[model samples]
Target: MDDTAIDYAAVFQALPGMVALLTPGLVFADANTEFLKAARRTRDQVVGRYLFDVFPDNPNDPGASGMRNLAASLTRVAATGERDAMALQRYDVENPDRPGEWEERYWSPVNAPVFGPEGKVRLLVHRVEEVTELIRARGGPTGGRTRVLEAELYTRARELQELNERLRRAHAREREVALALQEAMLPACRQVGHHRVAVRYRPAVGALNVCGDWYDLVDLVGGNRIGVSVGDVVGHGLAAAGVMGQLRSALSAASRVAMGPGEALNILGRYASVVDGAESATAVTTFIDFDDHTISYSSAGHPPPVLVHPDGRTEFLDQATDPPLDACPDPIPRPQAMTDFAEGATLVLYTDGLVERRGEDIDAGLARLADSLARHREEDPESLADAVLLELLPPGGATDDTALVIVRL
Candidate 1:
């Protein structure tokens, strides 16, 4: 596949119909070529101006309701985060050649919401179709009998549109609730002894921002040790999140009393066998002991953690890897690995989303991560975490959720 970057701004300018991008507050962000041509305006004249300020109601038409009606439709879209199509109306645009002159026109206008990552209406897509010629062909300004028939058709179309809008709103509400639940279950970042720690969780682009990736940091009973883990469940959405919460809680609880990372995962595997939707989940656990300067780790079909030394060397903690949770029919012991670290080493634990790409070799992804770690080995954990994400993720984001934890020793 070609790795060339796409110029979305150029694409938007080339789109066929009359379209404009507006902020939630109705300020014009951009307008396509057709839109500017139809309005007889330049991009410099409209962009960054308020919608009504740019296209105010004509002073000559005392009874003109075009501005009022269009404002109502746009307001509904911004407030409800839904699309709104306005009924046919008479709106006039200024005749650019003639100062203080308004040319009468009719239009079919629609406003749709654009959402940001947190699911709020970040912008509004305002699209308008000029129907002046169609109306004039029917019969002059009023359209005679044709106007009445068109009104009836519009009424029926609006009825169906409203029904579909209601269904979409319900689905959006459910998605928000599920996302909130997952966020509440995730642990907040905390320092591990004198070392700095940073954590980040990002859901996939098309998954409604709901995914089964999670990370945890727990202080062990002894004062000098801490447990950190990252996990990914098989699927996405509400069910996957529920399973993730259960498994995370079980493993966190087991990490306290269990002898090592392997024992803790063994307990979690047993618990996962009984939980619905918990099969085939992958996880990696690491116990960092500041006093002993040692790192004990275990993996359950998860990507290996990377350790970056001060001398610009990178190491993968891959020796303890085993099959995913609940993969074996009967209970069995999990593998465990340990390694010594220098005082200035950085340890990174992450889910597979950070490395895996569709139709690409997994080794390529691992090398990408190793390169990023080596380049930024001297950065603190917070900055290193940000650098890794910026280097590894695509422009739009990954296709799967990512959970990342970085500990600076």
Candidate 2:
């Protein structure tokens, strides 16, 4: 019991470690001078204190471990003593010397049974060392520091996953809206008066979705004449497609009530100005008449129709069209522009998406469009529309929209 007591004191005190004696409840019982300095508190302040009680919560700190059931974990280790020698705990410790800032700490906890006078285990000895600098040098969060890092990473990962999911849903919604609008706006195969009409409608080249392009054939004046029309609403996607549907309905009704294409378009423009809340300012119209003979007719502003002559020659009837619809109220109707339709002749009604280009000259593009029709003049109206549109429309899809109506007399 008294073997070299003076030497033992000299060696243990100067051992260059944070040595401490702790009760079973983890309260400080005794400590070396090094231990007092590391805890950043003197013996009077720390001797009887519990570990967590000294380190109170800091509300704004992200490194703080929230609520943990450490009591159970600590109890298990203490009872078994299986992992006591090799036990380690990591935590975020507010710098004991400096308060708010935290550093990672690793505690290599060694538990030993202290014997009483009866040779039975009466107390536990917990030796501690402040390894915050060592852990920082190794680039790790230890003790409470590790828990803090884990919490921050978990929360960040959850937020990132949620953001990705939200983006996916937004894309899906846009696709659905575009699809529904296309179905509602595009023409379906149907007849105009006695002429059995077939409609083939596709979105603009490159766009892969519906734009303001539209086509329609109306039974004019109760089967006396068939009025065919095609127009492009300015813009892209759902907004333009919506306007196309409105114009399609109005154009059909207007043509049916009036006697000729010119008068019909004039009335259409008048009504459009009233019904069109915003688009009344920008609307284009072109008309087609088929009654045994074909006449290329236009009203308001629109791309002129390409006449595929009975003699297999195609020409763009480029006389200036009247002012665009809805710009003025009840505008005067000009004489219906006429082009004689041979029995074998086909008339191509198309929106400017067939010819317009961003970098290329507009007139040359139109001429090319006319030339393309002439090349494909021998093909059936349905086949002719396809071939010409594919060639003249070029690449990158329809930046605007396109509509095509072919009338073969």
Winning candidate number (TM-score) = 1
In order, candidate lDDTs are 0.88, 0.62
Off by over 4 Å in 2: 1-161, 193-208, 275-292
Error of 2 at 310 (Å): 2.3
| Model 2: lowest-lDDT 10 consecutive positions | 80-89
Residue-pair clashes per prediction, in order, are 0, 12
189-250 per-residue lDDT for model 2 (tens digits): 55554454445556765453677677877655543466677766666667767777887787
Task: List the candidate 1 regions with Cα displacement exceeding 4 Å.
Answer: 1-156, 191-194
